[model samples]
Target: MDLEAFRSLPEWPMILRDSWETNAGWWQAGFTEGSDVEYEEQIKPIVRVGLGGAHRILDLGGGDGQLARVLAADGASTVVLDSSAAQLQTAHHRGSSVVLATGAALPFRDGSFDGVLICLVLEHVVELDEVLAEVARVLEPGGRFLLMLNHPILQTPGSGFIDDVDLGEQYWRLGPYLREDIQMEEVDAQIFVPFVHRPLSRYLNGASARGLMLVRMEEPPPPPGFVARAEEYLQVQEYPRLLVLHFERRP
Candidate 1:
């Protein structure tokens, strides 16, 4: 069921949690981590360049400490914060300092971290504004926050890759672009995850209202092998797969 349909039912939260909790082990099998190559090559460089010399960093909602391991490998003092206990267990096993906590209520003190990395996370969070406020509160003055998410435009509800075989035209079809809603997406055949959709304005305006300044934004192009695959992958060449944003806490 979609978010709207599930909202009317009282069991949505339990269902959502069950889906993630049950799939936590399967999720760690790295089938979903195919983008790690892209992250290491494209995403991490942007983060390192943006952070400059930041030492203490928080990987908020960093499942299984994937990016935390990357940052730690790069010589940063990194901590992985996630709401999933099962996921945290995997992160802990990977030698990452894992904290079990929601983003809406970070347990750290003010100015506790010099930088924060949130990747493919906000779309699953219901309390996005509250989380942004908490990010601003915990980050040191002039600290930066790097965000990477599924592109709001390309990933909106009902949007999908379209292949016109006869015309030999392949592209993406956008759905209701402006609506904020919840969508249940199939990750694997049996797993359905909840994704909350919000407009780009919601992120920028929300961060701005919380004393965070938007420093830069990037929609990195697709890797060569991505669009070189099947016809369904061709749409990636016409649009970005992720939206990367850099925000700074004001002094």
Candidate 2:
């Protein structure tokens, strides 16, 4: 796969350690201030994960807890956890109950939470299996898990390179989405957090191994801004912005 040069030149990691964590900091500032597209397409739907009741929801990579706050407002008991102090500060400032922590080694006890939401989170974790194990351990029997992600199939390295379609500047011009082997490290300048694009089977099998059952897996349709942005490049017939999943813990 031929990858174009990485953009966001001088690529610096924002105070938020991971992708969503930085986004949470932005969300703390009314979100609409910047990156509203991500906020709309990525964050909002997860907030509706357990819309009706007040289940205890743990926002796994939930930076400033924007989604946690929304869930809390809906009367759900919510806790946002992230590794960055800056992001946690933003989360608290935004009125969310948040913890400064890493997803791989969560601080909560086993079976402590009723539900867990890993929105745009695992992509950044260096230890995906550890994080999934922690998530499974924290959830109670029959609890739910909702995950949001840019689909690996469409985002795979070669998916955008087909000649029949011109992915335009933005789509055609970014990291090659699918490449099994990639390595880089930049701590202070860029987030040291690594990203992986394993197929859906990787996620499903891991969850099953940990005694979690898939209740639902949905490709949430993109929001208006998302649709428009994609249109600028190509007609996006089937790229999922969010993977709304529901999983139940071992009974």
Candidate 3:
């Protein structure tokens, strides 16, 4: 769908949630524990360290509680909150403390969590400011907010590996990096997921305005196992596919 089409839909959020609900089974099966190499090797490690010793953790948009289960295994009281009931059901069945809610309006008290994690979720959310505000509100003083995303510049719509035959070299091509728009990504044949493409500054500045101070930022390349899956990725191995920002709630 085009930008105008997406904007015209007043129930976009609900529509998005419905899409996830429909794809919940597929997603669960595909990313089940240790199935995704990037999550197992890179994302999980970084998130764990970013959260530090926080006992009360909130996994925002935590679908099926994959990360939440890992954090809970480490003895943290990890609560998985997601908008899709189908996703939350799987999480609950997997022994996770699940909450059905949206990130824009968290059904929790102020300073409810010591650490908040929103992994690869913001891209799907149009209400970025509201979600960030809710994140800041729910995090206690000095709490960490781990914001993980598919690298905005690298993963932007139309961005991909360009195999230039004339040059006999492969390079990464970036799409309309500065232009923020919503695009649909096909997960399966005829199954499309919507993503909001925003510049890097948008996230950093938005969080900063919400009293979420940036502590550290990591732009890591694709994991070995991920690159090993395809020959094309081997050439652009240095390019980061993930952007992780560790932010602290300003006291």
Best by lDDT: 3
- Per residue, candidate 2 scores C-alpha lDDT tens digits across 1-251 of 11122223344243225454444434455453245676766566555744446388899878667777777777889998888777777777768888877888899999998888887666555456788899899998877777766676554433443343464334432344435422332323543434455667777888889988887778856666766764443445355646666777878
Candidate 1 TM-score over all chains jointly: 0.89
Please list all clashing residue pairs in model 1, or write none if there are none: none
The whole-model C-alpha lDDT of candidate 1 against the native structure comes to 0.81
Selected candidate, larger lDDT, 1 vs 3? 3
Rank the models by lDDT, top first.
Answer: 3, 1, 2
Which ranking of candidates, highest TM-score first? 3, 1, 2
RMSD of 3: 1.7
Report residue 20 deviation for candidate 1 (angstroms): 2.4
Clashing pairs in 2: 156-178, 157-177, 157-178
TM-score of each: 0.89, 0.75, 0.94
Q: Write the per-residue lDDT of candidate 3 for residues 1-251, one digit (tens) a residue.
A: 44446768898877788888988888888776778888898988887788868899999999999998788878899999999999999999999998998999999999999999999899988889999999999999999999999989887778776889999988888888887788778867877777889899999999999999999988888889899998888876888889999999999
- Give residue 45's lDDT in candidate 1 (0 to 100): 70
Select the stronger candidate by lDDT from 1 and 2. Answer: 1
Candidate 1, poorest ten consecutive residues by summed lDDT: 30-39
lDDT of each: 0.81, 0.65, 0.88
For residues 28-89, write the lDDT of model 1, one tens digit per residue: 77432544456656666776776657799999988888777767877889999988888898
